[model samples]
Target: MSTDGKSPLPPMDWPDFQPGWVWLTGAGPGDPGLLTLHGLNALRQADVIVYDALVDERLLGWARTGALIEYAGKRGGKPSPKQRDISLRLVELARSGKRVLRLKGGDPFVFGRGGEEALSLVEAGVPFRIIPGVTAGVGGLAYAGIPVTHRDVNQSVTFLTGHDQNGLAPDRIDWDAIGRGSPVIVMYMAMKHLDQIAAKLIASGRNAAEPVAIVCNASLPDQQVLETTLSRAAADVAASGLTPPALVVVGGVVPLRQALDWRDGLADASVLDAIGRRTRDAG
Candidate 1:
């Protein structure tokens, strides 16, 4: 129980909520404004926040003064705290009755490993809540002025991880099925193996000239988007030195991006304007 009179007040003959423990939270993709109310509440109340590398640090400023922050980011082939260790630490902090917040980039359940951590907490009999966030596959695409689902393009969309933590294409994912099945495919963390991935999709009967859009550092000032055909995607990324923490979208929806893009006139503003005028004239 906390020393404060307002906190840790017990219910008559019932168990109390643990104060020192964790909330495994997703901060959303790059945009601080996208944080859920529950997530923001946890951040403000937490005694410590263990966060991923991709999480924008600026969001940490929202935490109450004197809160502790820990970095537990795991990047492919980069030195990082082991997942097991991170999970165990959450348990440890909770046992101590300290409010712990495990902050991750994007939805923690979407390839962010919130499940593993949640299971660990469950095993320890710790109560927890899931605060979902706007995942990169959707939000990142939106930031780049691309819509994952479009009435004219696709009614269905598929979200997939590019590679696993080991830097290999996830063995469990059926690339062939995904290539053949999904009308619109959005991938996260696939830049490193983009060449081989592109080849696989093509071999699975996807068109070589199918449009592919790669948006790196989505929703941030350093963001860049590259438009290419499936066959040229890997080569173009390589040539341009684009790196991961990027989102890739494939299929016809990539074409609409050229028209939907509204910022800095990257898309033809004149064209959309002309189309609007024509619609008005027709009406």
Candidate 2:
């Protein structure tokens, strides 16, 4: 663990991540410990850290003092800095010959708009490197004791965004195909539109009784997991009233959460019982 702002700047293994370029790195699903070694190296060496709303700020403490930190996060329905501006800023920073770190929550490439930013940097002739982190769909589910791939429950899994920034199920995605083809589904940023998303899945042949677990603030101390069935997910989540930056898992593996969940323990048995009893009731 490198101390915040004190290193004499040791030699780096990846010469490609040197100054004069931007590194788009994922900060993991909310836990600083889950940060990749490459991501941590970037944080320590960065001349600036341009981060998202979901990123854990504590991770910024790793950056050297006097490092410029920019907030570029955009939440759904909230006034936010435009994506074009954020991309332009990255180009500017690299053009200024600074070691830029574009820190994002979860995996940068996984719905983090990293591809857009990278494209902009490339078009501007700015050299860049990508450091992948643990995406929330997998890490968040693990924290909630939900395995994305279980031989008994599902041989395949599908990942989808709950809604587009416009607050509608993405028209670009074939929900019917995803619903019928994928045995397991993991959703990101879906809390607000879970009801509509659930309905679409059910209409597409997903069983209303399928188990669902919403893991909020995954991998963090304040994390909360809500367990419910597909038919009840929308209402139960609405009633709980948890905030965003959550991951939702829907499939038979949700039931395994009762036994496999090790993080945060079972003192909150309600989350576990919700799945078991709900499954029985539906049966």
Candidate 3:
């Protein structure tokens, strides 16, 4: 019998963190709470952790004692490590018999480029496990009270990257088909080319007055949600002085934020101030 306890919970059966293996795990947007148990488990046992720019630095607190933590984050327009070099470094670390954890923000498979790293591991004969985490496209929007899908708003939704490998808006996207078919569009890394994207959508028949929302620093206390129209999104965002690491959502469902925005109560005064500014501008 335990002292003042009804019963002790059974121990969790966690996977062993063996040396000479790499684990590509998602840290989930910016909130440490959103991290998966598997990710936490990996953190506690990792010999070395290579983390991304968007990952919450607080999560590193869970790393076991003496663990080496390396920053491998790549922010756009910043001096960052090349993808090939990063992948090769993982291979090198695994070859050194380290329990390597490549921690990325959001799901490793979604836009996080875990696939490329995984392929490199495969070619180099390094063992690895893929752990998916909550992507900002859905999780970030949820924190902002914007549902990616709604029965009344959209039956289907689309997710796309804002830019391609060349750091420019992707030329291969069929804007006309997407604008016509997708009732809701959630874009990643799109703020840089938002003006062009908005123009393309307008040319493809999407309404200029369609609702749009930009959620920045998603899931973190500093999260900001900016509301605007399709035609005015680029200008409004520019005027507001918001930066990257933001998700752009375009569709009819965006207006529902007026009622569904639950974060307002918990958000800091800056968020309220921004919202107030947007409201006054809209008026």
Candidate 1 lDDT, 226-281, residue by residue in tens: 99888999999989888878898888777666677865466775566553443233
Best by TM-score: 3
RMSD values for the candidates in order, in angstroms, are 6.1, 3.4, 5.8
* Pick by lDDT: 2 or 3, better one: 3
TM-score of each: 0.87, 0.90, 0.90
Between prediction 1 and prediction 3, which has the larger lDDT? Answer: 3
Candidate 1 Cα misplacement greater than 4 A, ranges: 1-18, 265-283
Order of the predicted models by TM-score, top scorer first: 3, 2, 1
Q: Pick the candidate with the highest lDDT.
A: 3
Q: Would you list the C-alpha lDDT of every candidate in the order shown?
A: 0.82, 0.86, 0.89
Which prediction has more favorable TM-score, 2 or 3?
Answer: 3
What TM-score does candidate 2 reach? 0.90
Model 3 steric clash pairs? none
Clashes of each: 4, 0, 0
CA deviation > 4 Å runs, candidate 3: 1-10, 266-283
Cα error, candidate 2, residue 212 (Å) = 0.7
**What is candidate 1's TM-score against the reference?**
0.87
